[model samples]
Target: MTQKITIDGKDYAVGKLSEEARNQVVNLRVCDQEIAHLKQRLAIAQTARAAYASGLRKALASAEVVEH
Candidate 1:
């Protein structure tokens, strides 16, 4: 079975693509992978930030009680 890629609503066989076109496809795939990775990293960082904020709020509340 031939690998097909769609571009601008048109489908082309990967095996028929020119060398430069094939290289561009590879670059696009790499870029897509990196973008997905960065998005996952961003989600993890956001979750950590929220946890840290919650911890800080709890710590401050405890400190207030200790001082009182």
Candidate 2:
């Protein structure tokens, strides 16, 4: 088996690496309610950064991107 990994535009040899690299996104609670919580957070964050905070809020409000 030939497996290669490229990171940061550089090739890194897998030395003492894990046999399986798995990433798990665990949502402790339902995201629907979390969105409201995030909105409140955005409001607090927006006070410090108007433009970027608004941008984040806008991006979060929009529909999820479809990855094909």
Candidate 3:
């Protein structure tokens, strides 16, 4: 079985690429994986931030009721 890679809407066999091209393909794959990981982390951090904001709001509201 042969592995194929697509670039610019065209498909080419990985085995036919030069060593430099193959290395570049590997780099592109690594970068894509890293980008996906960072996106997930950002989503998690945003969710946590939203939770923290909500908690702060509730705490402040409680404080105001106690002071009245």
Candidate 4:
């Protein structure tokens, strides 16, 4: 079974992909890529948070030692 699909304003003839190709596109690769991308973003956010907390702690310690 073959079907025609339009993509980017161009007509493309797409035949029914094999079972493996269909599974890879629909099940495996898309979700895996999304999960990997999210994990990367989470690591960056956690690092920024740790840096901010460290800066805040240093400022607080300095303030406590200042005698007025």
Checking candidate 4 for backbone clashes, the offending pairs are none
**All candidates: CA RMSD (Å):** 3.1, 18.3, 3.0, 6.7
> Which segments of candidate 4 are over 4 A away from where they belong?
1-25, 65-68
Clashes of each: 0, 0, 0, 0
Give the range of the ten consecutive residues with the poorest summed lDDT in model 4: 12-21
lDDT of each: 0.97, 0.61, 0.96, 0.76
Considering lDDT, which of the candidate structures 2 and 4 is the better prediction for this target? Answer: 4
Best-to-worst ranking by TM-score: 1, 3, 4, 2
Where is model 2 poorest over a 10-residue stretch in terms of lDDT? 20-29
User: Best to worst by lDDT, what's the order?
Assistant: 1, 3, 4, 2
| Candidate 2 vs 4: which has more TM-score | 4
lDDT of 3 by residue, 1-68 (tens): 89999999999899999999999999999999999999999999999999999999988887856553
Worst 10 residues of 1 by lDDT: 59-68
TM-score of 4: 0.57
Taking the tens digit of each residue's C-alpha lDDT, what string does model 4 give over 1-68?
Answer: 56655546975455655666555555655798899999999999999999999999988987857578
User: Candidate 1 — what's its lDDT?
Assistant: 0.97
Candidate 2 lDDT, 1-68, residue by residue in tens: 44445656966445433544311111323564699899999998877698787888899889687889
Q: What is the TM-score (0 to 1) of candidate 3?
A: 0.87
TM-score of 2: 0.28
Candidate 1's residue-wise lDDT over 1-68, tens digit each?
99999999999999999999999999999999999999999999999999999999988887846453
Candidate achieving the largest lDDT: 1
* Per-model TM-score on C-alpha atoms: 0.87, 0.28, 0.87, 0.57
